[model samples]
Target: MKAESETKNQKADSTELDQSSFGLSALNFKLKIGFDGKRAANNLTGLGNYSRSLIEHLADQFPEHEYLVYAPKVKSARQIDAFFEKENIKLKLPKSGPFLWRALNILKDLTQDECQIFHGLSHEIPLAIQHTRIKSIVTIHDLIFLRFPQYYKLIDRKLYEWKSKSACKRADKIIAISEKTKEDIINLYGINPEKIEVIYQSCDDSFKTAFPKEKLSRIKATYKLPDKYLLNVGTIEERKNLKLVVQALKEVNEEYKLVVIGKQTAYFNSIEKEIEKLGLKNRVLFLKNIPFTDLPGIYQMANVFVYPSFYEGFGIPIIEALYSGVPVVAATGSCLEEAGGPNSLYVSPNDATGLAKAINQIIENPQLQKEMKEKGLEFVQKFNSSVVTQQLMNCYLSL
Candidate 1:
């Protein structure tokens, strides 16, 4: 009797998923999809860009499904409108404090929107909607709390860990950005393998090839960037391992500058002090905010792109560098290997000597650089938006 009852429950859960209501033409029973994001469209870093690109593809690929983008404020909504103007994608920005806004918006989405699935782009979701009818899915970007507990304060770490564990437990489905991230999730939260889907992200269309020499020259002059420099793109954070890049420059004989591009964080003082100590004031340049459209030109002007990070869930800049047709020197292990593939020259993360040796190898050998650049372009095609989005659609449709 118990075995027969268990089979019936399994049948009921399977029946709850309406297979006929999939794809764009199923407007009569369209799945109202709600995406939660905190940042504005233009303020996109790794998570923000993932949300932007994935959501845009979702809107285009499945036009029949109702897509509602829930953000914290009108500024983000306006930015979304400007960035992604798809007819099916609707932006909802509530006028309230962050906490209350998330609470009220989530409550409304669960009750009124009649959404079949609610995806929390980040870890945190609406705790208040615990008893609501909407099914929940969360993307665990990384296990930063477990991986690098030293970087975050005690309260932040504790809260993040708690929320992440809870989300993993409650989620109907989970999406892991990388395999390493998936492993972390399994180790930390003990989520079932079948419950979590591994979907690798892709570079945006903005990171592709540029126009003719004339247009490239205009963009190059506009930014006042060097014709050739070693590029490192990411925030000025300790975990990002910017110090290794600084130390590597001392070993290189090349005259090309090292350009560090990203916004300054609160803890950038140590990085600044290190640069001053190294007497690299002239050699190291900081371009804080480069326009989004002009990033490809900046990549075009680079001799090589290096990412010596100690840790990452998925390093998007490495993909951008590869897709931009630049030779890369990324760290050996972790998600860098997954992103850089077998074509990249790998070096130890914190070893300045190893980084310097890799940089020297690239600079001294012109043919190696050309060959690596070709391989990078070839490797990057596997992670194109169209391809990754189809994987995402497959996962969503399976749900």
Candidate 2:
């Protein structure tokens, strides 16, 4: 109890110091931006991908400015070391500190490093930094907990709402990954639409490059993948709506198998039960812990990539499928259309008949499949790193 009180007191002192420092005017010199690198260093999910891509592109395109990535600890250092090869980019890992002191320490380090602009890659910024002179930008991926409160516990929902609302209210700029998310912020928190910028995310470059047929065949043999299959990649959770895909497969009526790759949760038990109930044990395959290098080949080999997610800020897997030259069939009700483009087929999330019909349409028509793949490749060029990085640069320059 005493330790907790001391930590709170120290945080209060830091907040006071931050308020005093706010009077200093903005620096009139070269740009030095700092990023909250916790997600980039440890998380291999959507936020990590976004952080690494943004950092790599910015450093490569605009090497004149200094880029600093601050993290409390790095668990995936080897995975992200390539981004730090540039001379202008630096990774800042602070010494180990108490759990409660992390926020305060990050603020002190940012001030000491003299960062002109600080961008939070996820939906958080240190409270002390917001009161200081440094310009703040936060990337809000979604308001999922608020939108679907039943999926979250009461405590978590309150905490997420508080933190997100605070960041949106305090930060100088907000980067919403999709227009849907931006509208949610406006309607829920009443944040000005002018303050939010919608920036779409792109997939990794590995998906765009082609692999030799022999190499792809070798990977396929190693995984023992079927000759024809439908692929779906994402975390196995209830909101992702994977059961709908299973139900849709019952109507495929062909030799096509269903290949699912994702980390499983308790919700997966329900999906397994559904599969067993339908007697699809031999037709359904669940793959876990797939290497990052092999993912492109897996995607390239698929006949069609299906995403049955009910909601998302933006769908990265759909973009990845397009980059790998595979046609996509994703669900409606979110910003998936922005990622999959008009050529990709869409169906209602729970409409197994509609989804199955769309899938069979693409599978039976060779010309339609070819047209969708070609158009997807053409559409994905707009999300190339050069284009998206320039938009992010404009955000920093505006500040």
Candidate 3:
């Protein structure tokens, strides 16, 4: 602990420790790696962002290594434009049968490309990946469907189970995004705990940027944001528990409104109905379809960030909030505590009163807010991009 502490003080960042500290300074390992790049190419969801961030940062940190992105189809979009142009990262697609291409291309493309390691950025790797000589890894984001069965339809649950189990069975190593996910894999799927590594995820680099006051003001005007508000980011699904915050809003300080930013689901109908019944319709603001570029400013403009999700594999929004210098208030049931650290407050997902108390505590006290913000920013360095990328590289190097 002393050595680590001394190292942290010596370097500009903890992750910038001497490469020899990781036993990698002398090793000249330049690997050719492949990925199930669909998440990076075709998704704007959690899985998509995870793939894009990992790939892009890996390429940036280890420039000598070639990172091949294998996608069945590539979406034409602005956010994903970086992958197409990044050095050491190449996008590969099949000639035909786009749906079958990912499953069918593994043996051919990986072997032909001389890939030494193939990573499934989400849960499933190629079914035929085991047949080849390349070592394989799969990142299991969460077992939410298995953990909370009621939320998913039976057929969807079964399909997710099959894919996850197959990937765990076929992968040489399992990288769980959180310790809870690792435990779920072992408990639900009976995977060996020894084969699984807990690797946390980093939020986008944009969230860490400090926007100029003029830019922040422009964004505030564009969104028609309230003078001071609480922020929540995630999909508006039942498991996410956005309703908990809405319920708390009626009891918290009258001056602070709740700003909700996320994609909506049918569950939102119930949330809307509850807001209407509570007579706090004007107190809650919903920002749907906000561009990713505007997200950092939104987080920076917040008075506090609340994510009362019932469960998660790893809470990236918590990390984003910390990077934005906002204190976090999250649910206690899952990995939210890990993301928020000890200084940030945690309330039971079901306790609207406790949630309101925690919110008022942060909102009403300036010193507490400042302490949480400073300590939160310090705590989130563990999920720093360089740190996570190095951990991932070490995992690959272990093989």
lDDT: worst 10-residue window of model 2: 19-28
Give one digit per residue, the lDDT tens place, for model 3 in 1-399: 453364356444434454555565524757899999987999976778888889989999888899999887789887788677988999888745576677765568778889999998888988878877999999999999988999999999999999999999989999999988998999999999999999999999999879999999999999999998999998999999998899999998899999999999999999999999999988899999998889999999999999989989889999999999999999998888888999999999999999999999999999999999888988888887877887898788777
lDDT by residue for model 1 over 299-385, one digit each (tens)? 877888999988888888999898787888888657888888888888888789988888888888999988998878777776777
lDDT (Cα atoms) of all candidates against the true structure: 0.77, 0.86, 0.88
All candidates: TM-score: 0.87, 0.90, 0.94
Mind giving the per-residue lDDT tens digits that candidate 2 earns over 99-178?
Answer: 64345667777778889999988888878776898999999989999888988999999998988888899999999988
Which portions of model 1 miss their true places by more than 4 Å? 1-29, 40-46, 76-78, 93-105, 128-133
TM-score for candidate 1: 0.87
Give Cα distance to truth, residue 243, candidate 3, Å: 1.2
Among these predicted structures, which one has the highest TM-score?
3
Top candidate (lDDT): 3
- Between candidates 2 and 3, name the one with more favorable TM-score: 3
lDDT of 1 at 105: 51
lDDT of 2: 0.86
Model 2 residue 217 CA deviation in Å: 0.5
Ranking by lDDT: 3, 2, 1
